[model samples]
Target: MRKRSIAAGLLTGVGSFVLATAAQAQASAPDTQSDGGAAANSQSEALTAEAGGDIVVTAQKRAERLQDVPVSITAFTGETLARAQIQSATEIARQAPNFRVSVLGNEDQPKFSIRGVSTSDFNLNTASPTGVFYDEVYVASQALGGSSLFDVERIEVLRGPQGTLFGKNTTGGAVSIITRAPSMAADVGGYLNLQAGNNDYFHADGALDVPLVQDRLGVRVAFTASTSKGWIDNVTGRDLSTISSNALRFSAKYQDDADFTATLRIGRSRSNPTNIGPIVNGFGPGGVSSTGVNPRINPLTGQPLGQRQGAYNVIGEIRAYGDNANLTLTKGLGDLTLTSITSVIKGQFLNTVDVDGTNLDALQINFADHSKEYSQDLRLSSDFSGPFDFTAGLYYFKDIADIDTDYFIAGHSFTLAQSYRQTRTSYAAYADATLEFAEGSTLYGGLRYTSDHGRLKRFEVVPTIALQPTLKYNDAKPSGRIGLRQKFTNDIMAYAQFSRGYRSSGFNGGALNSAADITVARPEFLNSYEAGIKSQLFDRKLTLNLSAFHYDYRDQQFINVVTVTSVGLVNAGRSKIDGLEAEVILRPAAGLSINAGLGLLDARYTQLVLNGVDLSGNRMIEAPKSTVNFGLDYTAPIGNGDIAFHVDGTAIGKVFFSAQNNQDQAGALFDLNARLSYKASAGWSVGLWAKNLTNNSVVTGAVSVDAISQFTTMPFPRRYGLEVGFAF
Candidate 1:
């Protein structure tokens, strides 16, 4: 009955969305930038002359040339992704500067960070320190953060506190994705790509765009499906590694004239049997056993242990899982535009696993999570192109989540069921403008007033704990970017900018244990100062951009691991973080480019009381002091097609993995990825790609109490693949 009700609700919601789309279409105008004219022509030239194109980004809610932006950013075009073999958000982190993504027991709850500042917990109730946006719409849940790379035009990674333009938990940075819009012309073109690699990996993706009504309405649909055999053997013959996923997206647009346009998009993704491998000891050096003993053996049966051989197998065995539904609409209102995105995202994740792999008599555990999110946003901006430009907007979001976990220790069974419902409503009004003061100088300023209210209700069945918490926060922050640019000789420009950002505080659901139902925390604030230079030489064939930035952070929110109690999770203390970063992009030759970025972080606890003693001098956990990223790509013409070679590397400097600031174990690690592609015909191509080419063992985390220490490493071995594709 419950399943049926959910299905009915979904159908009704979609029906309403369709009606809204139709109504908006009737009141909208046409888009003037759809043809292959000035904008398109310029974009094409930019893509060919450089690795991708001279991207135009709305980082400040105003369209500006990417090169002209003084902030530290990494942008990738769809074509660049195809050449680099970057298919997912996790893959993008490997190449982007000062970025790292890691999963914590749950695949759906991954931690994302830039420049060593990140959220340390995987609780659904806590807002992510890093903000993720799709087509200008914010995705509020981590389950929906990983987007399918289909029909996407470009992705922009803005590294820094973007709280002013993005709003909310953007203490670290923001990731923006732009998808391809529908075309009104009758012409149709698409591409089919297939890839096969080691571990029986297979992937396929394609898209189709059709003009339903010539010059008035159009629709575009795309799909991606992939499967990969388990890479690691369980030794017991049980499959321990495997992954399969499928996604579909549809977009429709109607244009009436050059001033009004309406568009709607819906998308869904499903995956069967996702893998979160069992814990293993000796997987790398400095590793420790999670269960208790190493080389876990069956004590009762004297038989070899199965897949669950180690301690604390949080991610046991995958049963089945899927994510569904997203709807978005955009309307042009005369000189202003409004976008409303109503998304009903749902997922079911099940896992059954053996906690202790060595004991023939084992402990079995099962886990499941069901969640939904709804959000609305409205914005207004002027279309005038002059010395001054501006924008304003408002947003609201709500979410309901449920988690069920059962653990069976031999014959005894323990179950933990939690139902969490949270509502967040935010009213924000913001405006930004750029004033041209001289021939090559401009002034920018922005102001925002945001009021937020939230309520959380949580119920835990196992321990019989019911907790309710409510919060009200209001802040009026005025952020201005005063940048001065001087044209040294018409081809070179020097600039400097200063901006301030903030992130509000809220309840920490993960910290709600039996002993403590609530923990009071404060908001985090950041002030950034930066200076840079942008220059073009050799008749625009060579481009170089350099920037240096320093960030001052206060009242940073962090999670502290505490002993589990009957009531709920507990918090240890609070901390502060500050850092500096440098980025450089150089295009010394046409069709050849090199991008390098370096970050230096000094993060420590301002006040940590452990054992009734203040430990304010301790360093932050999992935050490396130094990190670097480098990329080199080269392409050459070969018969009607092109041959390209690309290489990229990421290096992380040594740092303490725990707040204790221990230096007994520290090491620097690096990873290298390379790819080569060749065109076989006018519409066909083939490529070979390899990742983790050196198979270097890198420790991502460690735990230590007193003198005993335990370490965890990802150790993703070398993987290689071959891909073939055709376009027409």
Candidate 2:
């Protein structure tokens, strides 16, 4: 059935191209001299009207107007990111709607999700549901997980499935990070930022951009350091605090603009001991301490219960180092243009943490992981006006990683190590063409053919038990999209599209225990149908976008609790999710803006049976039913300076934490930030800022374990600070 669908899609795509060509040939020929001048002027006008100045994006592997794209996307400029103080991917999560980011015990490992579809496993060998891309190159492993936001030009977040254009492993969505290119002009500028707040917190960041050669080469360097005192106290009278991190980044680029460009980047970061405070019972409902004792105790009685000092003992530390290099060559051949990108990246991380907190007795665990990735992509696109616009690309990726760990638990000590190597080679050919049937209406169709091959190996070791397993998987998926856009008026447009996406499967890292290990699962598939509208009102000052979508998911994979000896992860049954989303951006006046978004989701299991019991009506775990986000920002001119006020808030409705759909949790939180700045001169400024004015203690996440029947809660404390900066 899948093969037939692919064949039909290809036929339809080709037929559309043929019809468009015939129609173009029958129409009156355009005047080359006069029409060419008018077309150039129109393009210039369009670029001038872009949001934030003329910005170029490579969403389709070519520079194009963002407004002209048919997909729903959000683009953040470098200035905007700096104003919002977004330093990492985890911070970006707070601003995007229906998206969440989290880190496990290891700061070097990160998990990302969009619209409630995510992989929560912390294993080093598993693939993420959402894909991460840097300068069009994919990051291979979690060891290269968190990226520093230094000298970045822009970040594009494409919502929904992007399998048709981005290829495999992107069933949920994709994030693209575009770095700033070196400038040829001999100009130098830099910024220094210092922040200090409660909890003995301090942060400093600096950057310098310089032109190495006159209109030929350039270099940029950036560094960051931060430290904070712990808010939680330990019973052992030890200080559980975090030390400052030292991070440095350097970038060098050479460009002559003819046909070739080369760039190289190197970065190193080291983090001091990060304290994971003692587990306190009663913080959440039905919580108990690890030592099996009451959480709430009288400070003067009960043998002091531990010492209520503001610190815990040192647990572990992490250090990360990475290097990346890329070269791009572009040349025009007849009516077609060929472009090639070759890149290599290598990264290493070292993590050491104390598994258990104790004064006289201590338990510690150390982990070291490293990874290397190399890729090459070649693309050919046509610029000739032949009633067809198309692009084709070839991609190759290879990765190898190793992990070593030493575990110590009181009287027992053990060492375990594992290694993984994977080589994924994909060949994809995709093309999209638009048929101008009449004035203000067009038909668009696209098809993509992708072939992938992957191999994995795992080795486990113990004094008494040792096991090794090897697995290889291959798949060929063809995805297509057909859509129509009709311009009803000058300011209103409507669109409808049908698209398909797939996610490859691999080993389950969360199922690996010292005593038992389970087999891997297979890949999953998704089909989505969507329709939307875009409107501009009040003289283009207010914009509204609304979309509704339905998705059919098959062979959903999840972690299940079997018997104590056989607990592991597996591929579960199928499910369905349908939802609606709306976004509104209003610019009432100069220097003032309001943005709001809302999402409503309905997700449930369609066919799920376990242990002779039907589990069909269960709501998806950790998936919220509704979410809301709102923000207000205004900047006003003052005497020789400008003052800004901003407020943003997020609200998540009730959600179930478990598969049984019994536990319900909900919350709403608000964050307010304001700054008053005085411009000292042409290149310097000073500001006073305040954050979390409400000082509300909000819960961020919660989890419940079936083995112990205990729940754990994580909360974020309020913080406020002041800063000074300079720009030239």
Candidate 3:
């Protein structure tokens, strides 16, 4: 089905080339762009207005066209995201190829997975395989997830392991959120927006920029707040309101006439949202009729699953908060540039959920954590007078965290009250250089050396049992990338790359036994080989990119629930992932644009053992076999204003949420979104947007507590609203 859908999407993209536009259109992009930002160059009006132009990116820490970058990447400009009504990370994934970004218990913690590399366990102690950054500052905690897309800049997604240059070790990939810098051009120029919708929803977000000095200094402030009454019926109250979020940020920039620039930024985000929002679970294991032996009953209340009003007897809530600050300074000397980045982040969250999926008080859980991180980086980049180009950097990082959890089941409660403290000190030096020995060909290579040291201690008490764990370790790892690229023409390029990635090992804080589980899980190793082609065809009206990749893995971290009171990670030994991906963008005419992406993956465990049983050949959790994203946008000049319409959808293939691969745990998802907007020359506009038009009821994710019971969560219900905006 996915194959046929992909083919049909391609056909439509081609057929519309000669039949979509009625007339030429006008551009509706921002008037003045910001500093340290990529400027887009569009070929035409609609393409420029709705689709944006040739995006400039810093995926490799250097400004370059997205298509010219050797790595597989995707970029979303602020204009595109605003038009598409993408407010968060999950929405971005709906359009990105082979990417899936989800949250555990919502709006606070995000699980960002690119291709098939991911960490399935949703624990505060275990870090996500993918890395997330805000303006070059590494966000190291799940508590700091859910970055709001507002106030400025663009978002860049880099696929595949980035073991070099970046501050963190990520086996999957990275998501970079680049905020708009303080603007000196806009003395009083900013934007204000207000939105209202069904479900008693209301939102307000805006930014204000002030020029402190004519050409020397600028200051910017931004904020966003959203609130909505609950959608699902709740027995504990009238209804539960799960969609509540708020954020505030401030930035200042100082530039001198002598080629020196400095920027300071600080932000905070807080949300008191609803959770255990809605759920339905009726079938038993294997999805067969529940026999008396395996009764599908909430033992405490004897209530069957799949309740009509959301199956909750108590109110569940998630409290999340984050604070961050960063300072960036840059100086230019001839053809060489020196940069320094200093950042610190602190975050915490507490989540509560009704675990049993029924209107009974049979089982419930509360999980909470707090974390702090600090890092400093110094780098130098050069575009020499010769054919040689290089960028090198030195980095240092320190991280510490604490955690606690409680579970209540069957008239009894076990409080795994724990205090965990860990400190990570890392020092790394990396360099990447490209030498253009020939006219349109280049030889590229990079090397990174990282020395990581850390210490951890944990004390936990479950009921009357107490467990204490302590450990200390230090290690060094060397990683690098090698690639070759040849420009067949100005509009076409081909490249092949081999890269090695690494992730560190860490101690499992809570344990079944202090002595037996004090040591850390084994570190992970990954090697990837990829080749791809990028082309701008049909007079630059169409952009097509194709890639094939394979990965070899070793000592992978596979987290498993050992018992109700403890969890552990095991080395999955070895595994392999192979995949093919295609991304296409077509500008059928001046006022129409269409994009489609398809991904096919075969991810399997070649060797794995659990409890003396060989679990090899099992499909990886959360890794779908096939995925597709399709979108279309149309714009037309109506009177003195331009009206634009957009529609997009994503389809995911079947996937299991557990290692057991239970048929009952296998499911898929399909979501649709649309927008219509009218913009006039008066710096004012209005729009209507709808997400999940079909209100697709999808089983988003699941987890197994034991052989007899499991927990699950679904996608958010449909959301539609009207928005009004004015530019200052």
Candidate 4:
């Protein structure tokens, strides 16, 4: 059935292309550029825009055309993000193939999975296997996870293992966010946008670029402030999903056309959002009550609440705040360019949940944490004209976090408090190079050596629990990549690669029942083999990329639920993942653009034995077997302005939130988005946008408590809004 659906989609795309071609016979060439950013560039922006010139990227720690990189990546330009109203990480995941995000009870923290690799444990101190880097600085804590999409320059999603260049915690893949730099172009330019929508949603974000000294020094300031009454209607009074957040970034850059450049950035963000309680499934392992009905009943219906509506006595809330600073310097010394990047981040997060989702106050949980991180990366890149070119770098990272959690159960009759401090330090060195062996054939490979150290101290549980001794862990691992590439032509390239990815070992921070629960989870490793081709055919009017990958995974980390109230990280014996991905972009006419992506995956555990249970062959959590996305955009000149319309839809296959893969613990999702806008030649625009047009909602993640009930988390329901913007 999935194959048939894919074929039908292709046929539909061809039909649309033929119709677009017929219409172009009577129209002149329309402006194909859809950029609305102050830092706009003339190139193919994203999957939703026309395929035109080259897109420059730094996927390999060096600037190169996207088409030239051998890795599988999906990138979005600032203009494309604005046009699509993609303001959150989950929204971006919806547009990318083979990528998924699961939001836990806390709305701000989202776990990312790429190519069937992910971490399911919701431990605040544990870093995600899929690393996220903001301007080359790694984000080290899940507590600091929030919206960071405003005033961005470009976003790159690299699939498969990127252990060589990215290093550490990237057994899955990497997400790189490159912010727009202060231009030294002797021009004062800026952009402002305002948006209003249903559920009392209001958003305002803008960026201003100022030239302090022409062609030398400049500054850029950007901010985003948004508030919403939220969508989830609560019977108890205030809306359940309300959100209020603000972020600001200030950047200063000094550059000499001769050889030196330095940039400094300081940013801060705060969010206080009222969380909607999870949808309550049927009774958990405890089974139904004597009445044969659910034990937890909804007051309105007198039945178990299986929907998203909330009826909480104590409203679930989260306060997440962060401050970050980064400094980068680059100097050219003959053929070698020396670069340095230093970053520091500080954050505090507090989360409270009405676990039972009832006015009865059966259960509640409070989680709070304070975290700080410091990192430095130094690199030397060569710009040699010779066949052999290389990039080498050294990296150091350290993070410290203090966690405090309180659990209230049985109508607040029993309470538990757990506190711990976790610290991690890592050091690494890596190098990569490419050599043109023959005319158009090249050999590229790199190796990275990493040393990781972890310490957990002052772990204690209140109410006369044992005082846990300080636990320490240290390990050294080597990971790398080797690939071969052939440039058949200027518009086509193919590559094959084998890469090794790694995730550091750490103590489970979620363990609170006893000292025995605080066990170390050994490092997980992956061996991936991949082959792909990239081509621009039909006179650059069509772009297609295809890749196939297989992974031999060992010691896969998974959450082991010992009981309702206790959980820890344990390594599954083994697993395997096979995947195929394809991306197509077509410019059927002057102002018509279409894009489609297909991802097919088969990921499952090959061997597993937990407590005398042979639980092998289970599908990996959030590892959907099939995914598809299609996008269409059309623009036509009307008088002195242009009217553009865009619509896109994504279909995600069924996914399980637990390793057990229960029938009721899985669901699928399909989302549709559309935007209609008019851009005047005077640099002002207005648009109408709608997301989740069908109001589709399904369970994306869930947790089952022993003797309790299953709690599920869902995506935002539906939203439609109007936006006004001006750029100069």
Candidate 5:
């Protein structure tokens, strides 16, 4: 309660201060400077380039300088990622402020939490509030979340509600991954890389770009393949956490002078990994354990016997495959530009797990799912070169999923099999406009109307149980944002905004016992108030950005422990989130760069009643109060090549994985990553990289069984590797 009060006070104070400052700026800059506006834009762009190496982002569905976007965003270019040795998407959380990820049994399925908002339910049918997009097309299922990051262009993490432009499932925020496209202007070129690491890990990837018709047509192909021996030794013969995955992508582009351009991309990936199963944590209510403290321990040390070992009678693994395609078309119509994006994706996933972490097979599960998705986005925007410009778009999305699950407990004495199909559909229309009424001052607002519908076909189970044959959920809402951006000077800018975001309703897809157990949760909504400042100082060598926000959250969808053995989806009556974020980048020397970020959050349930118990004031799960990240990059010439070294780390405060805020399910962890590389003038490079240098195997997620026992999953241990690459 005291923390909430303090956060509230801070929020109120910042809101008042920013409002006053904005008003003062408005009054001082009442007259329009027609000719200076262009120069100011150019100057701002130049400053951004100098400070951040010309980072560009599409946070607002349009290409713009990162510093010029009113929203808070963190962007990483391909070069930066390579230098940091950040391969998978989940690894990015360490460098992003207020961002975190939790794995579900395997590396292929990751749940993202941003700014205290996340999906707690592990059901495959549920969608995350933080939407993940590939080239602007939303991915609805974590089953298909393991997209390869090879040959990428840039990654943008947009904070705050993007409902005005991104539409539904963006109540928290959005992640946009823009991959490299075929360029006709580029000559036939390509690069190849091979890497080897501990744990018998090996990786090879390459990309080739070819111009078919000089300046008119081009094609690009990229491929990546990797395999690794399991780091976790299992007494049951097969090792856990072993990985084997490969992916390939093809891109083609056509351009008709400067009037029209079209690009098409198609990709496919397959992964078959031996996943880490759960470890038993204490006993549940009235649950008697015949096997005391599973996993025979080391009596001398009083710890688990092996450094990285598990006793599993049943091997666990995940087999997943996916295929996707997207096409983007753009046309120039004088001062207006029209664009269309169409995408389709198909995926299949099969998983088997030994849930008890013991050799007895006390609990085990086998699950499989198939997914198909399609999306279309059409938009038009104007480049008036005047004070006014606008963008309008129509978006449509559809997804269908089929699920099959089986559970075995008590040494297979009791077994259950279930199957079901689910579908989701959404449509949205939105418009955003900006007008510079006065010099260095802009007014921007956007509106979006969204309609969402969800359905569950039927619950089919062996040993037939009576339940609802079908279920449906529907909602229509309006979400948008209004903000004022004031450029106090060419290098400094401030903005304040009020926005609303929404998450669609969903049905429970977990184990069911009766008709009453079949349930649907109401849609969740968030109203946000935010203020921020962006600045570049000291001759454009230093960059600093800060923001504060408060959220009025309602009907937050959460997983409820219905019984000792079953769980379902429910809605929290009310909740609140208050946060402040800051990022800094400095180039103090010619050969060095420093970057740092900080995120503070105060999130709690203001009103929540479950099963007649007043559980108010409980801290939200997966939300850490404080997070900090810092890094250093240095480069210097040595002999015939240049040597580069980067080292970064992130410290995350205590995080709760259970809604009850159980201490047993909470922990804090830190991660360190470093890379050293030398590039020669002859188009060749060699590097060494390491991740999780401390080998901190912290529990990232948990599943409770009737509050009697819990199953916890841990992150990968330390990994070190060396790579060789050549360009031609």
Candidate 6:
């Protein structure tokens, strides 16, 4: 009760402060800059003749202003992301609302969840509710998606279910990345960025663009490399938190004629990192023999501890590699256009860790996976001058994966292995249409049909139990959405949307003692409804967006560890989520900006009964009641150079790890990041940055093994660095 009260008070205080500041800015800004009563006609209206307040986005498959889109989205450009010190997708949670990323085996592999709907399952054949895409191509492997965010042009995070346009497994939401295109201009340009930070950290990013064939062909290449020393030094012997990584991307474009254009891109990435340190029984001194609930005390802070430096030691590491290639072709007709997309991805990773988190190596676990996927899409879009417009597309995806797990036990020196191969083939068809019957009002609807076939083979079962050598499953689903939007004024817009989304069913492929537990996992679905309003006040100097949403989810899939090397999925019962979110962007003066977001989520399991026990009314996993984000950016001109400063923070309320709603199964956390920079007149810049400035110990996730052991992971350590960059 004390923790919850403190968290609520802090969030309310911060939100109130930010709102007051925005109100003051609104009262002060003069409305001299004329909008000329001209509002944007489409959602992707790139630029306007007015001030630089409105942003353009392509969230609806067409160009439109942010305020005109019916869905909720938060977009960041390359420059903005860099300035915010956000290099990976996992860091996006610090700036967005109702979004979180949980790191798994290593930093390269992350599980993304939105609005309390996400996955903890690590099966190769299962898909994530939150879809991740690069350059419009879906990347199925979590081990490969993180590298794609490094050289992106823009990232768009859609808040609600984007099932219709995205097609499959997008019941929670979708993250879309658009990479920078190759320029056809007869010019050579590029950039170089280098950094040195605490903990012996070093990083380098470089890019080069060239016009190969004057006005017809062009190429661009970009690469990044980084290394960091371990943060946790094992008292017993070796260190457990080092990192090394490298990634490269090459792109080319051909536009020989006005009607035909094609672009191709290829990327590769590799990383090696020692295992992150885990504390002993994060929920306290509880054990299998004696279940005593005592919070693990941090040796450094003496507070309820998380995973960090400890007396015990273990030896383990992670090696991961990924490669992806994509090609897109577009052809223009008199009043319609045809497009084709081809994509291929391959990922391989090996990770090992000590299960006990103690010097006495009771159990050690190893997991390895190799995956390959191919996809193709064909679509046609009409540019009709009439009141009605539409777009239709067909997509096909194929995936193959091989996975292996090993469990090593001490004392008797016994080893166990669970190996399997999995494959999936999916096909989908979708169409979306819009009708503009009035000048400023529109009605839009979409539908998608998807079919998936999955199989698991070459299984190794428990020594005492007999299991099937092969398993196969097939499933089909239909998902879609409908929405209406109306422009009340030149600066005000309102919208309402309803959607249905689904996740595919598949084989669990676990080496469970019970054959029925590992045989199958059912599909899940969501019925979502949302309403929102977007407005620009004080002559576009202040922008505010507010939304309310409700989700009805059924057949939620839950995973529980059966052993150190294997886990089984359970079809947990129905759940419901109700949430409200608001964002404020205000510019009180030139070169000074402030932004803040508040999210309130209420999620609970409505009906869950197992073993004749009612487990309903429990809080949803990974869902926080209140999440608040606030930030500020200030820039001013000095004598010979300009100085800029930025500071931001994110706070999350209590989050539960399981559906049982045990008091000890929850935690709260916060983080702070800041930077200061100076720019010269010749396109050169230098900056000093800090992350986790307070060095506050916070837990991001925790899981309990029965009533015996609880494992917890923490946020990054305090890191301060100096950086230099040059642009052409």
Query: Per-residue lDDT tens digits of candidate 3, residues 633-726?
Result: 9999998889999999999888775565774354578889999999887889999999989787666566655545555566667889999999
Model 6, position 505: C-alpha lDDT score: 82
For 259-342, candidate 4 gives per-residue lDDT tens digits of 788888999998888866666555634444222335356667775543557666767678889999999888888778888899
- Residue-wise lDDT of candidate 2 within 366-409, one digit each (tens)? 65666778888777766555444566667676676666555554
Of the candidates shown, which would achieve the greatest TM-score relative to the real structure?
5
Residue-wise C-alpha lDDT for candidate 1, range 198-267, written one tens digit per residue: 8788889988888888878888888888777654445444445466777888877776765445666677
- Give candidate 4's error at residue 505 in angstroms: 0.3
RMSD of each: 11.8, 7.6, 5.9, 5.5, 4.4, 5.3
Tens digit of lDDT per residue, candidate 5, span 1-728? 56656655654565455444544444443232222122111110112232333465667766676767789899888777778877777788888899988876676788888899987888788889999988888999887775667887778888888889888888889988878887666579989999999999999988999999987889999998889998777766677878788999999988787778788899999988876755555463333333444344432344564646767778767888999999888888887778888999999988888776767767778878999999999988777888988889999999999999888878888877777899999999999988989987899999999999888887766664544467898899999999999877555678899999999999888755665666889999999998887765555566777788889999989887654347778998899998988888988888899999999999998999877878799888889999899999999999898999999998899888767777445577888999999999898999999989989878778766544456677777899999999988
Model 2, TM vs. native? 0.83
lDDT of each: 0.59, 0.58, 0.72, 0.79, 0.79, 0.74
Model 5: lDDT equals 0.79
Tell me the deviation in Å of residue 241 in model 3: 5.8
lDDT tens string, model 6, 1-728? 34434434543554444344545544554533221122212211123222456566667665566777788888777766787888777788888888887764556777787899887676555678889888778887766766625666777888888888787778888988777767667789888989999889998887898999986889999998889987765656676767788889998988756677788889898888887676546333343211233325433455543346653445778878988899888777766667788999998978786656655656666778899999998877777777677778899999888987777767328776767788988999999888877976878889999998888877664463464567888888899999987765556667788999888886775554555666677889999988777767665777888777888999878665544444677777899888878888888899898999888888888998755678898888778888899889898998677899999998888877667666334457778999999987787999999998878666655665445576666667889999999888
The residue-level lDDT of candidate 3 at 351 comes to 86
Local error of candidate 6 at residue 66 (angstroms): 2.1
lDDT of 1 at 355: 40
TM-score of each candidate? 0.82, 0.83, 0.89, 0.92, 0.92, 0.90
